[model samples]
Target: MILLGERQILKVVRFATIGAYLGDEDDQVLLPKKYVPSTLCIDDEIDVFIYRDSKDRLVATTEKPKLTLGTIALLKVSQITDIGAFMDWGLEKDLLLPFREQTIKVEEGNEYMVGLYIDKSDRLCATMHTYEILSGESPYDVDDMVEGMIYSIKKDVGIFVAVDRRYHGMLPISEALRIYKRGDMIKARVVEKDEEGKLKLSLRLKPLEQIDKDSYTILKEIEKQGGFLALNDSSEPDEIRKQLSMSKKSFKKGLGRLLREEKVELKEDGISLKKL
Candidate 1:
């Protein structure tokens, strides 16, 4: 049976002016003319993503959405109605987030992390209760780098992520190298597990990896500023972040490396490049 809100490979049963009908066991959905492959023919199988159209009928498209059944994503609220909220999931049909599915009331023009699921009425909907659906069963270990999508952020806790769009992970505020928003895709390294066994992530690169990056940044900055920068190891953390977009510790390390190489000299007020 063809499932909604998922990608399925189905054989083309027939063709029409509008498009090709793909199905198995009498269940079919229209692959719109625009989405139908130019070389597609009857009885030929094509892979397509399935979702309900604006009219609430199952339709097939070659386009893929950011979120699908059993998956969680950060979606923006496009409109709010008395019944519920509509989110733009990059498809013709806006995914619905029914009031019952929302953990909290949502507002228009804001993004929230939501889970995609078919409701009781057989209609695809978005739900904000995403914690229940994330799989903590990740095959990862400390210091392992993984890619993930940011779904939510809490100032007190950290940024929530869906590792590989399946396993759960979080970038703690302490390890966050920069600000991130919902829907941001980032690469992070696993630090350790929290008390609850959830993955703790760090956005900063490993020490050696970061040193090279920081060194490059410092060199580029000195070049940009005509071979001088008004920052030293004693500079405030916030000042370092503003000037170099790096941590105070990283800036000091990079500066120390430059000094040891005789590439720069420490001044009472700041640091200056050494003569070539």
Candidate 2:
């Protein structure tokens, strides 16, 4: 059977004006002349990725698309037509992004994260609505370091992530140390599994590692501010958060490390670089 949206090693059975008809016994797909290997001949096998063309006809190409069936990726909008937008998926035929599949208003020359799916018409198309298509279960376990793309951010909720572009994961606001926007690929550690089996993620480094990083940051800030900064353990939580983008608890922990190492001297009003 011919597999659409997949690469298959098909045998060349016959020739045509446009290309060579490649298949086994029961099925054949056209391998366009441009994609036909110069040394290819009848009964010889060649690898080709198959998909429907603009006319919805089954066609084969030597070029591989960035995304395939049941896969999600960040694709660029190549053009916009009356029917829908076309995404350049590194294939001869731009993948279709129909109006109904668009989650937001898309325009030409911008990139959008989308998923590929076969529609009721048995044609492959791209859709911006990917959350529903992402799987909730994953093979990853707690504390496993994983990477994912940020899909959506919600106020007071968290940033929704599509792990491996398939599994569902989220990085909560409390764990976010820096600002992250949609479409950014981030590396995070799995903190726990949610009720639905989706992953709860943490972008912060491991405790000891974070302390080391924070200590370095505090020392650098103090030096940058003329060898002293008006920030100390007694500083307001909001002020610490505003300056460091970290919780007061974390700032205190980092400050303690710096003080213990004699790297900085803490005073009533601020901290200063220790003179060696």
Candidate 3:
């Protein structure tokens, strides 16, 4: 059976006119001219995405998709109007992002990582605020390490995150040690639940002592690599954390200890082992 507003892998079954209707089931949905891929034949299985047209009519398309329906996608804003902004979703018509539907009005040429869905009007739309769509049980718990896409930031409040795009979490101000703006992806930890029941997240992991078992592994890498590692202070905090999984303060402390013992020499570019 063919499902509306969904992509289905269907066998061509037969050939039809430019505006001819076709479907595997009796519903016999219309395959508009725009949806037809060049030169097709029967019994050939092809992937097609289905959606309602401007007139609220069912239609199909073979356009390379940015995302499947019901799933969230980071789309680019193509145009903006007083009414709304249109996002390029690899379709003949751009998806509408109504003003009321947006967390913030996005300007053209900007990209917004958003959750896409069909609104009450059956029109495809997007929203930066996805708490309503992502509220529920998390496949994670306190102290659990997780990675997420930075969708948006509410200044002074924190950043909104979609953990693996399946769970909801927030990086609070106190624990956001590093400066991060929207679209800056990050690694975080599930810290606790807020009074409002939202997930309280922390960008900083627990103290290194908490990862005692892994400390030996890290120390070994430092030793094998010559007791020293060079890193530019100009590197973004997020990038540094990605490389070392530790905050700048924590990393500096460790480096200082190694240098004080003459185990390593701080160089102009980075750190290197002291040659006796």
Top-scoring candidate (TM-score): 1
**Candidates 1 and 2: which is better by lDDT?**
2
User: Could you give the C-alpha RMSD of every candidate to the true structure, in order shown?
Assistant: 2.9, 4.0, 6.3
lDDT of every model, 2 decimals: 0.86, 0.87, 0.68
- Off-target runs (Cα >4 Å) in candidate 1 are 16-18, 23-28, 54-56, 137-144, 193-197
Residue-wise C-alpha lDDT for candidate 3, range 169-263, written one tens digit per residue: 78876566556766566777788965544567876557665344233333555677666554645556676567666666666666655556666
Candidate 2: tens digits of C-alpha lDDT, residues 1-276: 789877789999999889999997689999989888889999999888889887889999999888876567889999999999999999878988999999789989999989888888888889988887688779998988999989888968999998887789998877776688888899999989877889999876789998998888888888889998899878998898788788888899899999999999988899999899
| Candidate 1, run of 10 with poorest lDDT | 172-181
User: What are the clash counts of all predictions, listed in order?
Assistant: 0, 0, 2
Better of 2 and 3 by TM-score: 2
> How many angstroms is residue 227 displaced in model 2 relative to the true structure, after the best TM-score fit?
4.2
Provide the clash count, candidate 1: 0
